[model samples]
Target: MPVTSAALLLHHGRGADAHVLIAHMGGPFWARKDERAWSIPKGVVEPGEDVEAAARREFAEELGVPAPDLPVRDLGPFRYTSGKVVHVLAVEVPAALVGSPDDPASPDLTTRPGTSTAQVEWPPRSGRRIDVPEVDRAVWFALPRARPLLVLGQQPVLDALVAATTP
Candidate 1:
């Protein structure tokens, strides 16, 4: 059976004005990519671990900060082409936690260095291993803007979020 993953979709605002927090994948492969290179902060769920807990854990690990203590709504699971089922939870963070989307250098959006790292084979199958930050940076983007930036497989989570949040 494929491993089940979980993700935390952090957003602020409502309806057409909503924005979501997404992370740019780290390492050489993703270095020059922009569109389809970002993803919601996510990770594998440990056996017997609560899905929501794992989502929050991944958010902290990937972003290098604790997820805001806000009520999270389960947006449910989305299946990736790789067969991994990522359970998604959505949280509406305060403006203080999001800062200004126009300013990428906003302190609230900045992640501390050295908190998130991943081991990867640099030149695919070359047996050369390298350590890279799991996520180079995180940014807040309005819903429409975030759509094209997110990985194709995970785009549905945005739809799920809209459906779950819309009246």
Candidate 2:
């Protein structure tokens, strides 16, 4: 199996109720702007790693914020454009916890009990590295408002999250 990891679907207090923090994906492999450009914080999981645990780790790595204590629903699995099957899990973070990953003025993103944060370089060429702080700019959304901002396949994940959370 081509292994992949999980990500947190976050909504900031300032934006729409369903606003998710979508990364600009700074690496050379990703586009600098435009649609089909954003993605929830995600990565691959190593062997023996717990799926949820890996999700928490990847969330912290990509966004700089600690994983929220919100409930998680297994969104099951989906394949990427690369044919890698990813297991999706959704977790909610309150508005207070969502913000700019590059904001040096903000408090440090705290870690969940057993989880830790990691960093990766973007642009793939600058030889300069940047930390994955959960997300670049997290914003709230109202579903319809989120359409153009989210990565192509990611919209479905948000919809699934809303459906799972809805009464």
lDDT per residue (tens digit) for residues 1-167 in model 2: 66576665555332235555555554334435646666666777778887788877777665555667677778777776766766778655554554445321122223323223336666566687764433333334466666776676666776676666665
Give lDDT for model 1: 0.82
Global CA lDDT computed for model 2: 0.58
By summed lDDT, which 10 consecutive residues of candidate 1 come out lowest?
101-110
Q: Model 1: how far is 84 from its true place, Å?
A: 0.8
Model 1 lDDT per residue over 85-122, tens place:
98999988776654543322222322475357889997
TM-score winner: 1
Per-prediction TM-score, please? 0.90, 0.66
Which TM-score value belongs to model 1? 0.90
